[model samples]
Target: MKKTKVKVKRLKKGSNIAVISPSNGLASVFPHIYEMGLKNLSEVFGFNMVEYPTSRMLSKDLYTNPKLRAEDIQRAFQDESIDGIICTIGGYESVRILEYLDMDIIMNHPKFIMGFSDATTFLSYFNKWGLVTFYGPSVMAGLAQMKNMDQSYEKHLKDMLLKNNKSYVYKPYKQYTNGYKDWSDPELVGQCEAFYDNENGFEFYLDDEPSEGELWGGCIEVLEFIKGTKYWPEPDFWYNKVLFFETSEEKPSPMAVGYMLRNYGIQGILNSIKGLLIARPKDYTEEEKEDLKKIVMDIMTLEFNVKDIPVVFNMDFGHTDPKLILPLGCVVRIKPKENCIELVESPYTNKNK
Candidate 1:
């Protein structure tokens, strides 16, 4: 039998959250946006925020000190005062810090650690070793702009992090923004750009049957960084996994995204996974999205012949406004006919446990 995945206690009001910068030190550069996010965590979520040493370091300084970044994560888990951990923002080349992480410390004291984009490196790695990790908004990106978006965004974050729900059903946001406004401009610090209606919540391509699997995956571009590294999951890890993927703000072309999918097909991953959850590609035009959908279907159906697994597209996660918090290692059920995706297992252990 497979070893049981370890889960950490859920966060509550007044919980002390450790903020760290394992990726780029965007906190120092965009203090206005970062501070707004921290403010929301305090006033809105009722959490006490604790900043780590690397959370406000300069970008150049942080880039030169990947060891320091990894050390921050190590110390956060080791510190008894910290109830949970959240990232300042995502940045490129977080893979550099992976070498410095001590998994013994992280897995032993697994608590909530959430971030998306470049943070995928450590989040996915931690989950691979049986510790549940979160893939969601960071301080500068999603959290800062929470108040500007729909109120449901705040509720979703709280439900995932604070509440102990037996089963949670995910609903698509009525509207979403591709990205945020200029972070440097103090006037638009916490504001997002033009919003678009989410006409189709989730597009189901191969939903002939329902399936359940442990949720795994992150930004598709970030996953590419650890493809052949030890951080990459073993070949057997693909079995019964619902792999979720999305693009970054960099916005690779449809053909480019298809190339990445083709790689998974080549690895025989498409043949083993129970379901596939794809997020809306950031900043893609409507025409581009249709093209992406076609290419994805062609690759999975024609080339890989993966017919049984349920495939969904345009999910509300990754580099998008009002994102959902997806817990890696949690088991989720995908029902195609019902147009539903539900988290059947609680990702958190009781606080006293």
Candidate 2:
């Protein structure tokens, strides 16, 4: 997979942002949140939200229709009016759509596509084709909130979508939610997740003087699961990149985390990257945090034999509420001395729509 210098266009006010379900049809299971998300996308974000054939057509086993999902995505991209694409929600098997996608159509017509969780399947796919994708929020869980969207989360999202053509720097705030309320509960229509304070900032490792590169990687479990699949980038593709990965609500044990890193170590990926931006795992207990950190440090030292890799862990994103919108393949700087992470290049271009 030879790579090219691929840049994508950004979103603008009133631009059509197509919403599609790339994985599980969570909307059928939770219609209220889906509707709320549509309303929010229109009234709050001020975008002409459009849905394709399978955006909200939910089912238990019906999500296996990868062709439908893939076609919806292709159609969304082919639609000239659409300026951005947001996945409806993440599911268990977004990888199924890989074989069905029209890669030429997608690569030729790039837009600001953003997702996470199972959508890592597609995020990594587009990125491999040299198009920058986003690893961030989805429709139901992020755009549609119970009471209201988090102020910080919406601001960053808008910053990226509305073409803030400058180096973007995200600040550390002592507020975030680890999980969420049940979206299926009809009684909790106006409720959101509770916030927790005392959440630590991004912790540095091995004296992170400064490291910079384009963002790579996605949900750790998904990355590990998709390993050896065609979607996983080659070893050369991992070189000189800032690997961004986070765990999900599944809460794989520290042992599992160790094994995953060991696999990366064996693949020479651990040594290939300039730095790691590890997101705070979902539902991680305080004790488990220290335990996981020890596991990572040990693996990097004893097994991988690559110590002193610059790392900034415990940052907000992944399944966590009020997450940051991170653009894959955008040049970013991790400055440990200033305790700051900033984007150096504008991720957006003033191209066609």
Worst 10 residues of 2 by lDDT: 145-154
Please, what's the RMSD in Å of model 1? 1.1
Give candidate 1 regions above 4 Å deviation: 1-3, 351-353
Write one digit per residue (lDDT tens) for candidate 2, span 100-148: 9999999888888988998888888788888889888788876776235
Q: Model-by-model lDDT, in order?
A: 0.91, 0.79
Q: Residues 1-353, candidate 1, lDDT per residue (tens digit)? A: 24469998899899999999998988898899999999999999899999999989999999999999999999999999899999999999999999999989987787989999999999999888988999999999999999999989988998998888989999999999988888889999899999999999988877568899999999998999999888888888888999999999899999999999899999999999999999998989899999999999899899989888899999999998889999999999999998999999999886543
Of the candidates shown, which would achieve the greatest TM-score relative to the real structure?
1
lDDT of 1: 0.91
Q: What TM-score would each prediction reach against the true structure?
A: 0.98, 0.95
